[model samples]
Target: MWTTLITLAIGAFGAVAAFWLGIPAPFLTGPAFLVTLCGISGIRVAIPARLRDVIFLIIGTNMGTAVTPEAVATAGKWPLSLIILSLCILAIFLIGARLLQMWFGMDRMSALLTATPGHLSFVIGLTDDLKADISRVTLISSLRVLTLTLLVPFIAPLLTGEPLPRLAPATQPMALPALAAILILATALGLLFQRLRVPAALLLGGMAVSSLAHAFSITEGSVPQWLSLPAFATMGALIGTRFGGVSFRMLAQAMGASATLSSFAAIVSLAGAYAVSQLFGIPIVTVLIAFAPGGLETMMAMSVLLDANPAYVAAHHVFRLVFLTLVLPIVVSRNR
Candidate 1:
């Protein structure tokens, strides 16, 4: 308990420092960088699971406000990009599996599970049931998310060549009564998705409810900054906690594997994004976010930060998860 508090304090310091330094996505990246250092240095850091869920719900609900009439009109442009996105995930999965097997000394099952993009909870469950090395999979996957979280902000700007737009939070925040009612409905639907084994259930539920409300003008304002700022910080801190209890030596052993897989997957994502951008006239960077092979929660949160098309980015990620769910077992079973 004390450790968690200390970790959060360190994370808070990181957030303040990043904001002071004018770093992009300060609230999200600051704590993540600092807490990750603390974690790698062998400190005990943690974010409670419930708090993590709150982060998801708030961010997801906030994302719903990005659904505008313009975004709706762009729906026609998404199918081509999504189709390219499907191919990108396949390339990442197949090449990543082979890369791990060839260079990292990981067995097929371990490599396959480690290389599979997104769906960490589902992959970990498979590791246990399939008798693969849980630690290796966890480490590699965590490293991927951490590395992307740290690198994307800096790298994405270079790729896009356009200054990020500043979209202020809504002037009027959601009413307390409406916020509470929305959360209750989101949580109820989230629980239903959880029972059905859906990935990012709480997030999707919040997004679904909020999107519907905003679409119909039932909800009048966005999630408040008071809630969102802390949520982003907590998210960054939670990301850093992914490395807690891991040794430097163990991390060193996995870094090469993680880096190789991460680079390859990123390349595939970039390529697909470029193709879609050409085909559809969408910003390459926005398409890149949609194609990024990272956690749905994290990527969606980043989308909110970047002010990308939430409906577009969220749709691709949700599709990626569904695609992975249906295809992973078949790929593994056939190979085995």
Candidate 2:
């Protein structure tokens, strides 16, 4: 309890720094940076696994509320586009993993996990379960996520040759009762998915239930801001704490490799975004945000900040995450 409070307080400071520095999605990114700094400096900071899972549930419910019938309709036209985009994203990780294997002399498991664009928590959890080189995988994955967070807003426009729109505040707010129902439904489904051994089950299950509720008109509007801020802070702390066991030398080396892979990923994301936009007639910025290899919250927050279609962005990210969960373990099994 005290530990959680201390972490959140530190995260609040990071959020302020990110805001003052004009970083996109300052609430998450800012705290992430500060906590990570403390983590590597030997400061004791932790968020228990149970608390982390609850935070995932909160974020999942929030993102799921973005899935209205209209959002579902928009996504319905995206099957082909999603297929192609998934292939491209898969190629990026495979090729990037190969590069890491060859250059860094890393084991197949470590390289593959490091190169994956799956959700950060999901990847970290898998690393622990698989007994992979957690230090290496954690460092590389953290660098990739942090790099994308800092770089995508600035570089995505250049890559897509499209200007970002001005920030517009989101207008939808779900009723408190409806929000409660969504949370209950998500928690129930999350337990079921966990029983089925699904990856990131809490998040995906909650998202599934929330999407269903909104798509069927059982509820409407987005998750309230009052609930969202703390969830975001919790997520930031989780990412920062992942640095706990990684050495500075290993982190430095991984950062160098992560920069190269991130550059490649940015180009792939840009090209894929352009192609998918042409195929589906969605806005380029929207496609880019959906396909960018950042965490779900970071990208969704960017959509809100840039006045892009948050629902559309959220849908694509949810799809990517669902797809990765189904496929990543299979890939890992084969590599082993």
Candidate 3:
């Protein structure tokens, strides 16, 4: 416990120092400290495994509210655009993974999975399950997420301007009875999807139901804003904990390669998103969230911060996660 506290203090100090020095450190304010804390204390903070599911539910609920009938109608009109964007992102990751594999001489499967800029825990767990050089994969994926999280905020504002617009104020808060009903409905939907073995379905399904309710004008009040932020912060902190488990030698080796690959990946991803945005006539910030190679939580946080279309951004990342998980393993198997 003492060590954990000290490590966290050190990480906090480091973050401040990095900011003062104008260093491009990504995890400094988020998971980086938790990683340090865990390293020093050798103590694991065991958040219930179910917490991720809950966080997803919160995210889904928030997102669902944003998808009005108008947005859905717009989406339907240009469904092909979303499909193309999703495919383009997957292609970029595949190419990037191949390039990294060549550079690092790691196994193709390990490199591919690790190089993927998806959810950190999901990637880490999948890579481990596949027995694919967990250290290398974790290192690369972590660096990718860290780089995107740090860089996107700075770049997003420059492209989209600072002080982005917020959604209009919601109507009167839902009464207690109404709020309870909504929760019950969401919970029920989540359970139904879970039983069906949908991937991240509980959260996604809950969000979907809630979103439909709002779209149809059934709920005047949206999910509370506070729900998303704290949960996302917790997710960020949990990601940082992974760094704590690394040995000094492993850390040094991973840092150099991870940094190079991540920088390259971010550049490629940003370019792809920009091009797509121009072509689709969508706001560039939306493209960035769609293309940014990071966790859903990080991207969603940025969506809120930048006042970009949070629902759109969240949808894109979620789509990417689902897409990559389904496709990458198959791709790896074929290649091997």
Candidate 4:
């Protein structure tokens, strides 16, 4: 309990420092950077599964709040963008896996799982079943997520020519009754999704339910800043915790591979984003945030930072995740 408190405190402090320094998306970058340092320095940082799930519920519900009728109208372009996103994911996985195999001499299974963008937990869990290299997979993946988390805030502004404020602006808060209703429904739906073996089940469930409610004019308010800011902080901290128990030597060895793969995935994602933008008239920044090969949670946070339509951005990411969930299992079975 003391350890959890200390770890959370550190994450909070990181947010304060980042905000004080006027960094964009401070609640995210700050906690992510600091707690990652704590994890690597062997300072002992851990977020319990229950607490983590609660954070997801909050963030998922918050994201749902951003759904307006205008956003629903804009979603018409999503199918084409989603098709393009699928192609990008395929490119990143196939090319990256081959690179890992050729350059690092990683085994086929390990390389394949390692090359998979996002869906880190799924990959790691499969490592044991497939007898793959958990250490290699974890090291490369941790770096990829961390690199993207730290990189996107700086990159999104430069790419979009839109300057994000250092702090997210306050909005009207959600009514408690409505909030409770959404959460209860989200939880029920999330559990159903989870039982069906869906990735990001809770988050997706919350988003789906919340979007429905918002679209129906059931509620019209933003997630309270007090709830959102800390949830964002926790999301960042979760990224950093990926480094806990990782060895420095392993991190160093995987650096080149992770960097190369991250760069390649980003380039492919950028190209796909560009193509979708041209085809559908969506902003490249928004598409990129959706199509970026980062984790769903990290990219969701980036969507908020980019001030893009959260529903539009998150839907693509959810598709990417759900697509990966289906694809990864097939590859594993085929290779075996």
Top-lDDT candidate index? 4
For candidate 1, the clash count comes to 0
What lDDT does the true structure give each of the candidates?
Answer: 0.84, 0.76, 0.63, 0.85
Backbone clash pairs for candidate 1 read none
Worst 10 residues of 3 by lDDT: 22-31
**Candidate 3's residue-wise lDDT over 1-336, tens digit each?**
564444444445544454455442222334454454465355544334566667667656665666665556546424555676566666656776777677877777777776676755666666555758876777667766766766765676678765333232443454556656766777788888879765566666656777777878887565664554444444555456656656667777777667767676667777777776777677887777767877776676556445556667756777777787777667766766
TM-score of each: 0.95, 0.83, 0.77, 0.95
TM-score of structure candidate 3: 0.77
Better of 2 and 4 by lDDT: 4
Q: Give me the runs in candidate 3 sitting further than 4 Å from their true place.
A: 1-46, 119-131, 163-174, 226-228
lDDT of 1 by residue, 131-192 (tens): 68899999999999888777777767788776553233445788989988888899999889
Q: Select the stronger candidate by TM-score from 2 and 4.
A: 4
Q: Give the winner by TM-score: 1 or 3.
A: 1
For residue 187, model 3's alpha carbon misses the true position, in angstroms, by 2.2
**Inter-residue clash pairs, candidate 4:** none
lDDT of 2: 0.76
RMSD of each: 1.7, 3.4, 4.8, 1.6
Which residue runs does candidate 1 get wrong by more than 4 Å? 165-171
Candidate 4 lDDT at 288 equals: 77
Q: Model 3 clash tally?
A: 1
